[model samples]
Each structure stands twice: as C-alpha cells, then as structure tokens.
Target: MARFLLIHGSAHGAWCYRELIPALTALGHQATAIDLPSHGDDPTPYQEATLSGYADRIVSELQAIGEEVILLGHSMGGYPISLAAERLPERVKHLVYLCAYVPKPGFSLNDRRREAEEQPLMEAIQLTEDGLGWTVGDDDLNRLFYHDCPPGTVDLAKAHLTIQAREPSTVSIETTARYAAIPRSYIRCINDGTIPPSYQVTMSEDWPSERVFSMDCGHSPFFADPTGLAGRLDQIARDIT
Candidate 1:
C-alpha cells in the first residue's frame, strides 16, 4: 500500500478530507490529512502566514513519514506542495494536484489565477473589512465551491466553512525547479466553476508525467465522490510504482 499525504486548500482544514481518508485507509493506504497553518488547530496567526510559512508546514509534515509518500495537494495548497516536493523529491514519490495550481519557479498563485478565468470570480469574492482574507458567503457557497455537491453536503460545509486567510493566498511562490521535473499528475474536476476547466487543461500541459484524470464533480471532489477519488488515487500510486 502507498502512503499518502493529503493537503487541504485555503481556509479548509483536514476536516475537508474526513470522508476520503477513511476510504483510502480502508484500501490499505496510510493517509495523513492535516490542516494547513492557521486554518485548523495549528494556532498560527493569519497575519504571520506566508507562502513560505505554508511550505514550511508541509515540509514539517513530510518529515514525519519514514517512507516516501504521495504528496497530494488541493487548490491553493498546490503551491506549497510543489515547493515541498522540490525540497525533498526523494520522499515525495509522486505529486498529485487536484484542480490545484502547478506553477513555474518564481510564480505566485495570483499569476496562475490570472492566467485563468478565475480572477473575476476571485475579485468578486467577499473579503474581511481589513481586506486580509477571502471567503464565500452562505449565498454563494454552493455555487462557488460545490455546486454539484448534494444539497445536504453543501449545507454541512456551509455550517463548517470558515474564513480563509488572504495572506497565504496573496503570497508569491519561490521555487528552484520547474514542476516538470517531478512525476506529476492533474486531477481535474470537469464542472468546477471556481477553477475554469480551460485553465486546468493549460496547466496540465506543463506536467512531466502527464497522468491526468477527470471527475464530473465540482471543486470539492473529496466531498462529492470520496470513494471514487480515493480509488483513482490508489490506481495512480500503483501505476507510478
């Protein structure tokens, strides 16, 4: 069985993968899903969090595993995961980006977002009064992040969704290698409104391995199809090995 380290996106915690972890674990893969800094119980202040801060958090988590593991990142978590894999490529067996940004060196998440149609939607997202963070209000939650999700699942996320840190989202990424050096794969969600499918296809073009998969779900595939998602991840792991 392959060991997997799953990273969550902006404002989301390990709680986002609660449904998927058990499914992956039941398949005999050891999955470690942890909250990003300042998002969950990490206790880091949002004001102090940067892209490097987030990358440091991922590296710290990767260090705990004695064996090489598949490093899977979602949404904004992709930036840090890419950096983490570069820093310790040996420990990262393969990098799986789920509708996440896969950027070149010195590029920021904003750069990737600008290359897509997501900029307009991001600019329209609600922000805190200080303009330090971004979040979707209850009215836009279903349409933005999980339109295809079951109404009940959307309601559950509405109750649990909290404000995401703007600091991390705005921070630029600094890296040494192009993502093409790693055995990378893209898991595109076909109907995602938040991340335009056009942009996903463009980003995957730069991947070295080019092992791409698609789900007919929205941005939050883990919530929409945890079992199917986990099965695909397992298959990818096996194919790579």
Candidate 2:
C-alpha cells in the first residue's frame, strides 16, 4: 500500500483532513497530515510566513520519513509540495493536486488566479487589517469551499480555519525538468466554487487524460464524500505503482 502525506489548503490545518485520513487508512494505507507554519497550533506569526518556509516544512517531513511517498496537496498546498518535489524528487513517488494549484515555473497563486478563466474565491476574501493575511467571509466559506459538505461540517471548518498568510500567495513557484519528471495527477472538483471547474480544466488541459480525475462534489470533498474521495485516491496511488 502507498504511504500518503496529505497537505491542507489555504486557511486550513491538517485537522481539516480528519475524515479523509481515516478513510485512507481504512484502505490499508498509511496516511499522515501536517500543519504548515502559523496554521493550527503552530506558533509562527502570520507576518513571518514565507513560501520557502512552507516548502521547507514539507521537505523536512519527507526527509524524516526517509522513503518515497505519494504527496497530496490541497488548494494552495500545491505550491509547497511542488517545491518539496523539486528538492527531493526521489522521495516523492507521486504528486497529487486536489482541486489544487498546478503551478508552472514562475507563477504565484495570485498570478494564476489573475490568469484563470474564472475565479470564485476572490470576492470572498476578507483581508486582515495588517495586510499580512486574509480570511473568507463566514457566509462565503460555506458557499465557496464546503457547499456539498454535511451539516455542522461548516461550523467545524469555521472553528478551525486559520488566517492564511499572504506572503506565500505572492511567491511564485519554480519547477524544473526534474520536478516535471515526477509523476503528477489532478483531481478536479466539478462543483468547486472556490476555484472554478472551468479554470481547473484549463490549467490541466495539457495533462494526459489518465492523469486527470474529477469529483462531482464541491471543493471540500473530503467532508462531502470521504468514501468516494478515498477510493479514488487509492486507485490513483495504485495506478502509478
């Protein structure tokens, strides 16, 4: 069975994968989730966060594991995982982007969003007074990221979501041929209101058909459809092996 490292998206901590982790484990796979700096319980200040710091955190985890594992990145998590793959390609058996950014050599999250055919998360952002972070409006959070999620799920998300740092959003990722050589796949959320489904398709048009998959649920499928999500992830991990 494949070992999996699940990275959460913007304003989210590893706690967000509570359901998906167990579901993946039920498939007889070892799944682990980690909080990025300033997220969850981490004490790093939001103003101090950087893209390199995010990547380094991921790379440290991979190095400690000392074995190749499937690295799954959600939302903004994609950029850091890409950097991790670049730094330790041999330690990453596969890179999976779940309604996540599919970065190119010199594009930041903001840059990609600007280039997107359509973006749904932009209007939902509530920037911090200090200009170091942003948060989604409470009402928009349910609509944008968890429309299909179960009742009470939105409340849980609201309670746990951290203020996402802005530094990483402006930092563009740099991918090399070596990182490109690492097998990558994308799981598109067709019902996604955060990142439009059309935009997801646009970003992955060049990828082979087999490398792209879709979920009927919204962005937060881990909460909306854990069984289906887990099954698809299991199949993806198996296919590459």
Candidate 3:
C-alpha cells in the first residue's frame, strides 16, 4: 500500500482532508494529512512563515516515514512539495499536484498566478493590515472555490480557514534537477473557478500524458468527490508501483 502524505492549500489545514484520509484508507492505502505551520492547530505565526520553512516541515514528515510515499499537493501546496521533492527525491515515489500549481524553478506562487488567464481570487483576497496574511470573504469563498462542493463543506471550511501567510506564497521556490527527476502527476479540475482549468492544462502541458488527469469537478475535488479522488489516486499508485 502506498502511503500518501496529503498537503492542503491556502487558508486550509489537515482538517481539510477529514473525508479524504478515510477514503484513501478504505481503498487499502495509508494516508495522512498535516497542518502546515500557521494553518489548523499549528501555532506558528503567519508573519513568520517562509517558503523554505514550509518545505522543511514536509521534509521532516518524510524523514519520519518508514518508506517512500506518494506526496500529493493541493492548490498552494505545490510550491512546498516541489521543494520537498528537491530535498528528498528518493523519498517520494510520485509527486502528485492535485489541482495545484506546478511551478517553474525560482517562481513563487504569486508569479505563477500572474500568468493565469483568469484571476478568480483577485477580488476575493483580503490581505492583513501588516501585509503578512490573506483571507477571503465567505461569499467569495463559496462562489469561487466551493461552488460544486457538497452542502456544509463550505461552512466547515469557513469556520476553520486561517489567514494564509503571504510570505510563503510570495517567496520563490529553489528547485533543482532532483526535483525534476521525480515522477510527477497533475489532476486538473475542469470546472474549477479558483484556478482556471485552461491555465492548468497550460501548466502541465509538458507532463507525460498518462500522469495528467482531469476530473469533472471544481476546485476542491477532495471535498466534491473524495471517493473519486481516492480512486484516481489509487490508479496512480497502482500504475506507478
């Protein structure tokens, strides 16, 4: 069984994978999700969050694991996961970008978003007074990211969502050949409003066809269809291993 280390996106935490972990486990895989620094229960201050620091936490998780595992990054998580891959390429069986960014070397999430055709979250973003963190209004959050999600998922998320630190997203990730050598996969959400679907296609155009997947869902596929998401993940694990 492949052990998948799930990484959540901006403003979310390990709590975002409440349904996914169980679904993956039911499919005979071991899955675990952790809060990245300032998100969820972690007390790290958002102002202090750094891109490298985020990657360090992921590397620490890999160091603690008994074997190489599938590392799946959701949304903004792509950045740090790439950094983790660079640090421990052999520790990752496959690097899966779940409706997440597949950044170029030295490009920050901010840089990548600027290259997008649609800036869905542009108006929704509410930055902190100190310019350290960001959040979205509940109305925009529901419209943009949770439009296709099941009822109550948005509410559950709204209550738990934290102020996303800008430091990490703005900081460029330094990737090397080792990061490129790891097998990679990208799951594109076709109906996604948060990140344009066409942009996703453009981002992973160079990726091998077999590893690029498309789901008939919105931004948060893990919430929209955890079972389907797990099935896709299962297929990847099976094909790769």
Model 3 lDDT tens row, 136-190 = 9988988888888889988898789999999887878777789878898999999
List CA RMSD, all candidates: 2.0, 0.9, 0.9
Q: In candidate 2, how many Å is residue 100 off?
A: 0.6
Query: Per-residue lDDT of 1-241 in model 1, one digit per residue for the tens?
Result: 8999999887788888989999999898999988777776678766666777777878888887868889999988888898787777778888999999886555678777887855536644788787777777777777768777656877777665666777665666565554446787899988887889889888886555449998888899998899989988988988988
What pairs collide in candidate 2?
Answer: none
TM-score of each: 0.92, 0.98, 0.98
Choose 1 or 3, whichever is better by lDDT.
3
Give the Cα lDDT of each candidate.
0.80, 0.90, 0.91
Q: Tell me the tens digit of each residue's lDDT in model 2 across 1-241.
A: 9999999999899998899989999999999999999998788988998889999999999999989999999988889999989998999999999999878767898898888877688888889999899999888988898888889998998889989999998988777887989998999999898888898898888899999999999989899998899999999988988
* Clashing residue pairs in candidate 3 (N, C-alpha, C atoms within 3 angstroms): none
Count of clashes in candidate 1: 0
TM-score of 2: 0.98
Best by lDDT: 3
Q: Which stretches of candidate 3 lie over 4 Å from their true place?
A: none
